[model samples]
Target chain A: MKFSFPKKVMAAALCVAAFAGSAQAAEKVYRLKMAETWQSNFPIFGDTPRNMAAMAEKMSNGRLKITIDSANKHKAAFGVFDMVRSGQYDMGHSASYYWKGKVPNTLYFTTMPFGMTAPEQYAWFYHGGGQELMDKVYNKFNLMSFPGGNTGNQMGGWFQKEINSLEDLKGLKMRIPGFAGEVLAELGAKPTNIAPGELYTALERRTIDALEWVGPSLDLRMGFHQIAPYYYTGWHEPGTELQFLVNKRTWDRLPEDLQEILRVAMRTAAYDMYIQSYHASAENLEKMLTEYPNVQVKDFPADVIKAMQDANSKLLAEKAAADPLAKEILDSQAEYMKKARHWTDVSDKAYLNNFNAE
Target chain B: MKFSFPKKVMAAALCVAAFAGSAQAAEKVYRLKMAETWQSNFPIFGDTPRNMAAMAEKMSNGRLKITIDSANKHKAAFGVFDMVRSGQYDMGHSASYYWKGKVPNTLYFTTMPFGMTAPEQYAWFYHGGGQELMDKVYNKFNLMSFPGGNTGNQMGGWFQKEINSLEDLKGLKMRIPGFAGEVLAELGAKPTNIAPGELYTALERRTIDALEWVGPSLDLRMGFHQIAPYYYTGWHEPGTELQFLVNKRTWDRLPEDLQEILRVAMRTAAYDMYIQSYHASAENLEKMLTEYPNVQVKDFPADVIKAMQDANSKLLAEKAAADPLAKEILDSQAEYMKKARHWTDVSDKAYLNNFNAE
Candidate 1:
């Protein structure tokens, strides 16, 4: 899988001689393939891979080409990790948490219940050693994982009933998934998984009392507001960042310049997706409110929030005790978040409160 | 000053022919010169242009070479617009607001008092109608402006005495500049200006009662925490976005792929600076609190905040009345912020409040 020259050697030679040795490499076009976890033409999520591929192609001046296969074409929505690691695909765009079954440490890279917000999480990734920690987890599998995109603070879920206290969560049938669902299960709630296509009928027919999809960015088109009167503010998955995975074998084949182009393209597309999600959320939320004026946005009572937080803490503590790597990532995120959150409080929170009050 | 080949025609041709016709253009190196507003080695501000140049060069395999001249070399901290517009430099890295004196509409692009935060502002710039409005302003001058970097939410200022009421702002002498100063002047505060190098001494020697630099990201280095006891939260320049200006002539001369490389490079670099600033602010704020425990971060009292907000609205109204274009730009921002803020409240703000409370 390795190219004629290694990346490190190419980078070093390029540094010493500048672009003198790489002129020949520029004439040859290198093409790579990617597999995404979303269906073809799937709005914000689907746009990320296409955006990344287009930017890489344009930036490399036709030297690098990338083609993408979505879930429909690949027939593997949840098989992204396996496919990427086995070299069935050069890269993948999916969530890290999806691989928690195979690699438990993958759970921490996405979002956590009552964890950092979008900006805070990004600061953690780029500056607070999150990237290095991610490398430690993924490097063993010969894969590199990067922050693919963010859905901002996801809404908790659409609830048919208002959650007044801890008693309300008892025996509640909710379609929640992943780590957050595990946290809720500890609180006497029945957290089930329902197919996306069945979610609306399930909620309407009371197959599930509530379901946590995404925020308004994806939720508006789902028509959840029509059946669920109360849209609870988020606690679980505050900043749900998706993941980008690159197989080491494929990466080792890229020329230094094309490698740089691919890296920057992925990075830019990741950030762009976050902004796109934010814009979509804002636009969609406004549209939802105007169209469905009865859709009430609610916050869980203090006691309910407290119960959920306690459950989350217990789960994290158990995970931390079981694995040293899990302990390290959690500790890093907690420490970074404490300081970053303080700054957020004084800067954005304070300003927002003042401006909103005015 | 016109380039031989125009970008629009090239872009159209590339779209019709795909990458079929542009292979030969990739071999020729197109070097561009850029002038920045900061001095050589000025921390975050200086890092942006260098980062952009490095990415553009590496991504384009050195076909797009951008060399930067800082204020130390160019001797014009505020002359970026003129230099780029006249083709003295192919590009310039500076704040768009700095060109307010020369181009009155330039002030609206950087940031506004009581406006959107970094992510919101970025969403507006990229997804909202901001880029089109910017083109309307810059096209006639033969320049293109892009978001260079963001400084996040700036701190209000440091005060010698606490601002408890509207009376406190009256007759208070402060070294604040631009539109914020005009708002302060409306409240009978003496808005003065001082050179950056002399600011610390001026505040200490009672030459000024208060002053604001940037937030903790850049302010800690300036030693503002040592002298000022009361550090106020921001009301002005919530998301202070810097600008990168490109001479249209230079942009048109480049092959389409190189142009795309340069554009994406500038964009990624700008977003990186914002994350860099966020990380630095958190790290520096931690440092400041640990090293100097006496520094008290305060929000302006509700009454004072109301007065300032009122003054801001009044000024914006006057500006809108004076010029139709100013009215157009200001209205666009106001409308964007209104919907965006509502989403921010229910999403990030609510989640942050819940997490911080726990």
Candidate 2:
């Protein structure tokens, strides 16, 4: 009987050990490939995306790994949207304004000339059913996306000539896209399409007289100061938004647990991108002035801005008449702007207007 | 005969129009879901994340869409990592520190006491080869990530007890996570793991006497002042980092075009979340003080802080010895810190320490 008990104990322990071994083998690790649209070291562009990838790796505990394919290693900046849509890869990164050609109505959801501020945009999207409407528009793209970031109102384009009057804008070939391009057309400046890669050549060769990318941080890296001496402010694209797009097929294949990880990781990245970019913009702008005295940061002429505003009103009306999709997005934007403007009048804008920037 | 010629011309024009119409369907809008990690209007957490989604939608002209599912409606904060990892959903929203159980090495990527600041972290990740290392680690988890957001060196956590000496921490129960908890243990304090929801309850019941959250802004939202009268600073979790995670399978399926959009979106969102959060943290803290008269905000005692520093050194060494992964991360961190510390001593610290907040 004692001999039997020892044998039984040995059998139980072996079984337990076998079970543990099987359990360990059953564990699976998921590897994710992420593509970022920004350059490797351009403050907001590179750092934020990289930080986000790191955030997910940490969060997953070696179970879910995300690697960011930086610039050049992947396609150029404008290639992000198409890449995510075709399911050629997995998660992607890019700005919404970058997709204006294929989806014109998307610009309303992105940045507009003197549109809503950060707080206002947040309120409308979260509560006013704006996020739902945005989703409605993205459904046709064959991919799913999450709003990952915003550049709190941007500086206007870099110009080769002084835009002293609305007349100067006539026939002026400028690299501007989306809604801003439409608004600029009304003011008589010809809004031209040019990708970031082609921007330098176009500007240097005088193929495009003006270009508006992002703020100083990214602008400095693109060598804007070297080509364009006249850099203007009064950001036409205010509170520009960016997003993370995942292929729908790929997204649907994941079990519910993994999907949640992507969403949170993207958000962490979005937030990180903004603050890093903002500080970088500040730092780069200072550097631009000191490092290169030839660069002139000028404010846009008020009259030209007024003319553009007039054009935007007319263009918006025309768009509402032509495309129903455009109309719905424009309507959402209008309604959101109304409430956002009211709130800002009381809070954000009020503080900024009252509080002097030290 | 002349009439036949005119008719032929009209027919040719009609044929061209028909061909153009066939190609006019542009890409379909793509929709995705972003599981929220916080309430819809939860200041830095909610507003920025939501706006990022909105920005992506607007910029994509509706070709890309994302539905923002607020925290709990989809999953709890802690659940975000698993949700994304298992591919239960496509995207996620959360912080890196939350997943300490999985990837201990990831903590270096997120936040640590007196470690790299936002800029330094970015540098280490991108320039110092930290990003690739992080990616390798994340790949083991079946996910890719981006830095979702950042709370600039977070405010020392809130504490009810005045920590004048290291002895005060003995047996003190604090709600802390990641390496910071280990440091606390080394210092003789008991670190407690508690969810954000249960935080107020635990403190109110004295189940946990002290809690360290993101910063003053988030602390105000939790109304920690009511339960903990004396709020102390937490130097340990300076610069808490959030993350957005994506499931690997879902990520690899995206086409190159959509990939660009998602990548830029993540970059944009990351940048925006940080600055907006910083601004919100400042405003909320000020508002909390004015609104709640009974609350007291105090910095950690010098001696107590010194002890925590000592604890950090020992804990780091122990971590390095036990886990190769932990050692790899820490070594990478220490390497980057060695280089960046010199600059921080001159630029970052000098500005903050000498500048006038007023």
Candidate 3:
């Protein structure tokens, strides 16, 4: 009698433990839908979410599934913030600054015209309280944001002509966007917003004289090299970081294990995407040189860069003065950059310069 | 058929379905022992493994447990390769160059003097066949290696006197280890290895005139600043990437889910440590300047840097001539760095210079 009762109890216990955290949880697949800003088959930007989802599913052994809808599918390229925050999609892949009009503080998370570079910005986010500030901004909207991937330093933009002085910038019809666009506008450049689909045509037709998309990784595919002869090195959006947005409710609904899986997958995918972008950009830049020999890679002259920098600083000062939270965020970034930039100068910067001095 | 019979059949079927792939395997814990190169309280280096283990355990829901044995316990700072290979320790946290004496090709996997920077080297590793090359070197040893963490760019060294010319390096008594030490030796510097605990005493008592430790992050704690005031910028070990060694047998035994969990955990931890090092370096560098105001951060003069570069190139050429695999690795790195450095120059380097120009 004792054996019979114990066997029954043991059988019931085994069933419960089996279904608890591990393989048994696979019986109920937790599927999440994500919206991304880029169109389907978009190079580095679109690949990030897909790579993340695949990792999460494989690591979780099919316990977690993420399905993505690109801009083509969703028909809302800049609406990722609203979609994820409102739970229209469980997550989103977009740049943080896209929602700057709605959340003015959101502008600072992505790269600034003269802010810290990629590694420095990442260091600031993980260790120097950038994540805390980001949380402060997104928590109100019931959203969580993480660094999606870095484009290294973005190109300044492609120009039909060289930007030699401040006069070269005045009324210059460039299709830059976000804070960089604002800075350009302050410097008297006519910065306009155009759909990415229309960027190549617009640039060719002189609807926009130049446009800053991304670096060589995504830029080569846009056919900008064929049309724009002067490809300028970056000043605006240096080390631009795309973002991953998750609805807090969606994140909370997962088991602890799945949550960790999703988090780690996203983190690895983000880092992977950065490396991928670097690789693609390197390869593409080489191709652009050999194939389109006339596409010159030039730096913005000293006077032009200085003018943009001055305009950037002035606009930042105005923004800092307008809002207390903005001031806090800006001050923190400035202080962090001051320290990090010094390290960069001593380390990589000096080492890179060694080649030139040779 | 009896109703009870059908119920039993249904329950058995459900059990089989629940325990199929993921959860059933996670029910058993995989405990691994890791040997680390640093001591128990070592800051950045020791923290990498702990961070990695914590992430692995949490993400696997306590399924994968990694316990580390520090140098105090293992008493083998340089014996990690053997420990992990012999299965005495299931894994190791150490630099790959430490094993170069036994396996000459292991030298290229870590860092090189005047080599690519952190981001560039990372791009090389993930995208440009680095992992494959690393596998070729480590596979025969029954070990698997991954980039554990990056120390960013290393400081050249702390000197009692300025390295103003090539003549200054002649017969200089320096306690610098690994490949960089060899390069210095080629330039007529007497490169020696000293115990970590005795480094400060060695530098202070004039036993060693100069010593290259890590950058500000780890060096500040070692009290190198007080002993030597002339802190030079990095050229040697431009991006010193520490390594994670896993015994192949141990890796092969884990279930698919646990394997994925461990891999992702290691990858994330590696990236996290790089950011942590960057943050620490920035903070410590700031503190060092405030506390030791007299300390001068100098770059080795153009002539001195040129000599070192020449020495490095000569040694690399010799290594390449000695072994076909070494030749392959060197050529791959050179080619990748050529492309990646161009991107870096046009991106971060250009942007960083803009600030200086201003």
Candidate 4:
């Protein structure tokens, strides 16, 4: 009878242990580390990664935890792609165009010069096969890329003098980056890239005659209006979208539920950042106009605009001819933009024009 | 020793039972019922709630489950607010304006005539004090409301004839609901609301001279182009946002993690629907233009637009004078829109105009 009671106790204990094992498995927590291109405490750009991480943790009931390392910590602002791809970091937040030197096709995923607006670009990404083309490019690098956030139509740049015609661009030294810089170079302008910290000094001392930062969202804080009188409207990077990178191995290791939680969080954060940027721009622009009314918001004259367009088209054609995948991605974007821009013209464009009259 | 062995057996079994109880609690399923204003299989509007529910379930790892009943199943297209408020359904998906007759302040939560566009309105809701105002209105009814989806800029209805001047609006019969209908009535037009099923027949029988529907995203499927030759651009309901309703009791009953899951899911779905609507509009508009070459897209004449604006302002001034809360909400919107629109003018509007010139 003693042996029987002890045997029953052992059997019950074993069953409970088995049940507890499965329960622990269900309750297991996953920890991931991420790298972001921006420095700590950067306004809209830095907020995106932290926002995404917080949402994921809350939605997943603490089952998923993500820790972020900013450029200050990682000391790899431009190395986000390589760090995430090599699994040194499980994820990254950066702009896709930053990797263009290493992977030329990466340029198409970010906003192209004179491309679709924010809403149009989002539609193209989610519904018009832009995501598929992005996958085709990023899959080759053992990474997954997603639309991180959008900076609405960026300002053209703060110019010292008005751009009257194509002649004004000749020998003009400007701090513009990415494909836009290349487009400017084609028009006999000397395009240069300067560190963000040096931009104000560079423009002030005539090291560069013009500089393009983000729009009112980030620009008003940079105190650019104090130095530049001619604040030109945008022609390049109309809807500049940032990117999120995930290492394929890191993604594959996650449970299905965590994967979905991370995805939805990133998406919501991206959309939220766009609205946040819009709000900041509106608020900051109002402040700028009310305080310093001398910021001349000008559109580049028609001749100057036309010349920039021609230069952009020529550069795109050369890139397309050099690589088959580049041609495919460019063609897809063009086709999607044609349909989307038409709708934009009829809907928001028409409404805005009509409302302006009132 | 024999008594001691039996005691250990009992204690082990009891401990297992206790552990099993906590595990079950952790895995408890929360099944919620959602009632939608749309009929079964309704396109974009119906898809939103289902999308939100799926995300919540997946993110919560099946702890939260939501089942939806459409208008046909519930037999109460307009009773969504009442059902959700009374706890007959845990949630509802509908437009806030539909409840304006019952809760007068519900009107402003949807779009307004000559108001901000989608992106601008989203900024107002999230960043400005719009969400707080929305809460004050919905809280009285024991419900929580959220932005369900956005239908970009609604078309200014399909018209059988062009509106050239104020005279054309005199005694005209049109189908436009809510505040826009009231505005039109001030200009000697008869504005009526017709059931969706009966709108096509009413227009064909000359019972209505003009009727507004959503833009090309949904209008093409309704075959409005075949019957209406002149389609006008939108001024009223520029960014018609739908609403999601949750019973306060149901919300209070959820765990914190589930609440966050539901909140994030609905938010992501709302943004997704905006992009989806954009894509559908672009695709369907292309089809409409290609298939129906005779259909003309027109903007209301300057005089007609000006008259409509004046009438809208008069109606708004009367509302603001009627109640203190109404005045507060109106003043808030006007202030936010002014700042947002100025930024819009310098950014998106300038970019589009420059791009159009090329």
Candidate 5:
């Protein structure tokens, strides 16, 4: 039998349906895909993106879901920038310097040779115009880049022999990559890029005389300490921060609440990784010393450090002269670093030196 | 005109009502009130809780709302712990050391006299056992404490006369509070607590010989550089971290999603505050130098530093001997700092010294 409700009752039913439909929309699940540069189960590097995604998902109460595809699944370790930029993936976890060849300005967003430390660089990024400069460079490419994680102060390299003077570095063959490699090349060192998988073999078999990997966090697993006797302290890539890249369109489409969740998740993950790296480095360094007594930690001598510094300065000057944007970024970093380093010198540096002497 | 044989339609309407009811429940708003130990508009200290509240609200889509009442409104600067404990307030933002009188173990959560720097302390808190120890302390009072923010490295103080020897500290009336003051008192320094508003007048009029406030981040407005010639570097409170206390009941009432949101928001805000403090200190220090050119930055003489270190060590030993829990927390920090400081020594310290010498 054909039956219809009264007008008031029908209006009330329609209102209820509208309310339920809107509520369902509010609870709609948004699934995003991310591509990371590291392979599956990679220690610190791989965990950063997963940590971020998990926080975002949990905070959003399953309404926001992010699935990550590692280099193993994507088969493109250095293709993170392109993948995220082209929207093939909604986001990417990689280092900004990895894309320097394609976009030269991307180099500065990651750590630089002889630049600010982690806290200093973070101040620059969040408060001293570094993020704006980063946005200026990445916005043109339809990508948003963020500081993903830090490897604290990276070790310079695992040297088979101590770098005592400039003469020692003249003919050295090392597996150092990116702008740092360029700096070494200027100082007459034969800098080369070898695959990560072959780094230990390369160093052990004398194919490469020395190689700079990450610090104790990721280095212990590679067995660099066992093969190389002299573990040089960091010079290049002091505070090596990884990058988080999101396609601009993907970011724009997110709801305000989810956007806040994603922003905070990435930030906390970045900070957490720095502390994690610090903890791991401390733990592993102790282990290396205890297990392998022959491993010697050395700093590059004054003259050699000076030579590298000069070479780095020359290279940076050339880059600044070549591009206005590069000039702006370099100048901003140098100015910020000057003030920040001054504070650091008087605070942590002085306190450490004074307390240690006591 | 009575409706008949419409049982199916009635059942459908009832189902819609149930859906709407459940949806409304899901959208329920959770309001929280926080009492802060700082006055309204207190720069870095006040900004932290507000930043946290804003992030939590946005991330929760307004479902989680936190309203903060400053000390001016609450009129109980030191009542934050008790307020949150008794459920008078849902949360609190204050320094952990402020509650040491009420709960002695609470002092360790803030910075110590000679302790780890910001990053080192953060590593100890998250990766080491600091957070667990803090939980153990706070959980007993039916509260949960989290790291609220960091003021970076605190300045030693603005001194009217330079302290070059331990003898200079004798009968020195200084406005330094908490455990550091106790350590100073052990060294024959007359340590006293002065109200914040009277600090400048006290120091300026020679009522107090030296006063240790925060670093340049909060020091610029006080005009201490103009009044005091010697701006000594930080020794005590290397990384003064503020604390966030949540009532156990308040935390338990939050939904899982809201809890996650709140957790991440506070973590990010704490990190942000550190960067902000670093940036402000850098900017303000530069301004201080340019404006007040006579302000001399000095480090405590080595002998004096040694004396202070011994005094601090002795005081700490007494505390550890007295309380088992205090011993556990202090021992955890000492062990963690040993390893972390070694890494710091070889990493950031080595890098900074090497680069600067270049």
Candidate 6:
């Protein structure tokens, strides 16, 4: 279904012109509808789609309204992609990683376990032409996506027992998702994607051997530490990103003025969200240790990191062989990384090497 | 004048446990110098002070050390009542509202005439606020301060012109400062209290029929906008806050951690200073204009807003009837204003606001 933007011309040129012409307009109101991934009444921090809807409504002076529908209320969790593509909703906020089947190249956009770090990923997407490629992929499905937010360098899942080696991954039923799950599957682990509301219950029922969510802020909110004692860090998915997908038809219909306003508002929200996340993490980290002293926190073994890294490369090659689009994205990202690595080495790393120590 | 940080115990038990009882063994890098305000540079868009400096030196592996000088650079600007009360620093980023005295309250904070709009004031402060305020108010007694920052809020300056009654502000300079000289004193005017930088210039050029400075951000910044435009939005002070003076003695002895890290690294450089401000004003406003073009963007008319708000009687009576400290400050402010008005509001108004608005 072609997503129809009800405001103006559907073509891209109209959108660009609207932005330049925005400064000279009479007062008008806009309402933005959204279909969220996180179910209502389920308290999950940084629940991508929900936060997007919430922030947009507030900043837009109530003139731009966003009606959010959680995944559970819409259909199955994964149904979000098809619904949005069919123009069932104006936008869909969810993890790209979850819809890897629908959009194979989206894995890199989400989390690839041992994929790129957060700062590197944002830099690439915003400036290194990665966003252009992703937009190319979305154009086919009638979607325009912006990076909603990120869960900076997550912690590894909570486990029933200590992971001693690669052998331990074998046959473990873990609630993991998307591309990361495939890599774990290769290691003989069974991967599952459970909605956040159902996660704690699954763990309580002993249905899964392990689960990984985000950092301390969300973990503390979710109370994962209470049910699972073996808390592990070095999550393969560092800087996990979420997507804000606007139905191409609806996005196209917005007046150029409204379009630019929405974009800037989103960017502002994205930047502020990170700041809020940082403070939340600092405060929550201290809270976790105090409330759950019995919970054991451990860093992932270096060898485990090595194993994942090795598997990631193999998986990338296999995907590239099968899908040309995947290969194109991978190739571009790889080139960007080569250049970015050198610059950041001198910039961020060098600075940290000097200061973040004893 | 070693600006000493008042030692306060940590609130968190864990932090206390980590640092307590090990004072002697603490790492003591050579102390350095911090140049300005709290949460100035670091805690926001730019690198935070503690982290920026720590990262810089941390990468050097302790080979280099830096210090921050907060609240203690020279004599406080305007009247830093709290700086002395709290003993926060040998220097401080201050505003006229705080002191309003030692100089006339109005002259101390408000800017004058068609002078020093936001951008211009920023330039003048760095170049002008430096040479003049430092020499006359600060260095006159051997102290120093630099321009912290400025927010633009000037209206063609609220005026009695719109009221069709410039006579309302007759013979009243209304305590304008900075460059509001020519415009304020123009219609039927006189300009006074002008600092060496501003004083001689206003008198010679014959600008500033009347003026004011800073409002919401700081009462000082808003002063000019309200008086001339007759736009009495208290929001004048909504965003005019600035930093100020440090005592030489205390600033020299501070340790590296608090000095350079928090101060020099805390504030953004002058040229790149308006990064966020530019975003808020230009980007957001541009977008808003498209949606809300009718937002009232006009100045105040003369008589309607310039009438005797009974500024002096209130200023004098309150100070005279109050405590010894209040009396001292009020008298100082009044003395300065008394001399300033004869030539300004009384003499200047005859030519300026009285005949305005063709």
Q: What tens digits encode model 3's per-residue C-alpha lDDT throughout B72-148?
A: 99998989999899999999999999998899999988888888888888899999999999999999999999999
Candidate models: Cα lDDT each: 0.90, 0.66, 0.88, 0.92, 0.91, 0.49
True contacts kept of 1: 0.66
Deviation from native of the Cα of residue A342 in model 3, angstroms? 0.9
Which digits, one per residue and each the tens of the lDDT, describe model 4 over residues A1-358? 7687668767777767756764565567889999999999999999999999999998877888999999999999999999999999999999999999999999999899989899999999999899999999999899999999999999999999888888999999999988999999999999999999999999988889999999999998888888989999998998999999999999999888899999999999999999999999999999988888987889998888888999999999999999999999999989999999989998998989998886
The reply for model 2, stretches above 4 Å from the true place, is A1-26, A38-43, A70-79, A194-207, A293-295, B1-358
- Write candidate 5's Cα lDDT for B178-257 as tens digits: 88999899889999999999999999999999999999999999889889999998889999999999999999999898
- On DockQ, the leading prediction is 4
DockQ of 6: 0.01
- What is the C-alpha lDDT profile of model 2 across A1-358, one tens digit per residue? 5775565556556544543443232224667676778766655656555666665544333445767786678856678878777766677777776776787766566666656654456545655566787787777888676666766546677889998887888999999876778788776678988767889999999999998887775788888888788877644665666777777887787544345546656765665555455445645666777778987766556666666666777877897999998788778777766644432332222222222121
TM-score of chain B of each: 0.93, 0.84, 0.95, 0.96, 0.97, 0.40
Name model 4 segments beyond 4 Å from true: A2-22, B1-22
Q: Model 1: what is its DockQ?
A: 0.39
lDDT, model 4, position A248? 97
Residue A294, candidate 2: alpha-carbon lDDT:
88
DockQ each candidate and list the results: 0.39, 0.02, 0.63, 0.71, 0.69, 0.01
lDDT of 5 by residue, A1-358 (tens): 2334575456566666766565665677889999999999999988899999999998988989999999999999999889999999999999999999999999999899999899999999999899999999999999999999999999998988778778888889999988899999988899999989999899999998999989998999999988999999899998889989999999999988888899899999999999899999999999988889999889899888888889999999999999999999999999999999998988889888888878
- Which regions of candidate 3 are displaced past 4 Å? A1-27, B1-23
**lDDT of each residue in A123-226, candidate 6, tens digit only:** 66765677798888887888887776665556777898888888888899999776778788887889998977799988877899999877675778778878
Docking class of 1: acceptable
User: By summed lDDT, which 10 consecutive residues of candidate 2 chain A come out lowest?
Assistant: A349-358
Sort the candidates on lDDT, descending order.
4, 5, 1, 3, 2, 6
Badly placed stretches (over 4 Å) of model 6 are A1-28, A41-62, A194-198, A201-206, A342-356, B1-358
Better candidate by lDDT, 3 or 4: 4
- Best candidate, lDDT: 4
- Model 6, position A247: C-alpha lDDT score: 85
